[model samples]
Target: MYTKLKDELLVEAYEHAVRSQLDGEFLQILKEELDRRGIIFDEAKKVATADNNKS
Candidate 1:
């Protein structure tokens, strides 16, 4: 189902998923698809996570 989304949509969805803290198998599918498509999150979430953890 997720494989049909455009690159931009997929990236947005993945970012939202990460920000929303959505997990389980649903998020896994997004992660797998992103990797399969060679699409990365650009470390936006990575920086966020690091900042969040510093508190």
Candidate 2:
């Protein structure tokens, strides 16, 4: 399902999840899928990780 999504939508979804501070599981799944597809969101990952640590 994730793979079927357009590249722009995938990145948009990831960015939204990070901005929304989604739960670890949700973010993890997205992150993993993105990584598997070789999509690098280094800054977003850093921000998401930092936010997760706050919870």
On lDDT, the leading prediction is 2
54, model 1: CA deviation in Å?
A: 39
- Model 2, span 1-55: residue lDDT tens: 3658755577788889989999989998987877766665465453233334459
TM-score of 2: 0.62
TM-scores for the candidates: 0.60, 0.62
- How many residue pairs clash (N, CA or C atoms closer than 3 angstroms) in each of the candidate models, in the order given? 0, 0
Best by TM-score: 2
Model 2: how far is 11 from its true place, Å?
0.8
Residue 24 lDDT (model 2): 80
Q: Give the alpha carbon lDDT tens digit for every residue of 1-55 in model 1.
A: 4657776687778778988999767789988877777664444532222334469
Q: State residue 42's C-alpha deviation in candidate 2, in Å.
A: 7.8
Q: lDDT for each of the candidates?
A: 0.69, 0.70
Model 1, TM vs. native: 0.60
Stretches off by above 4 angstroms in model 2 are 1-3, 41-55
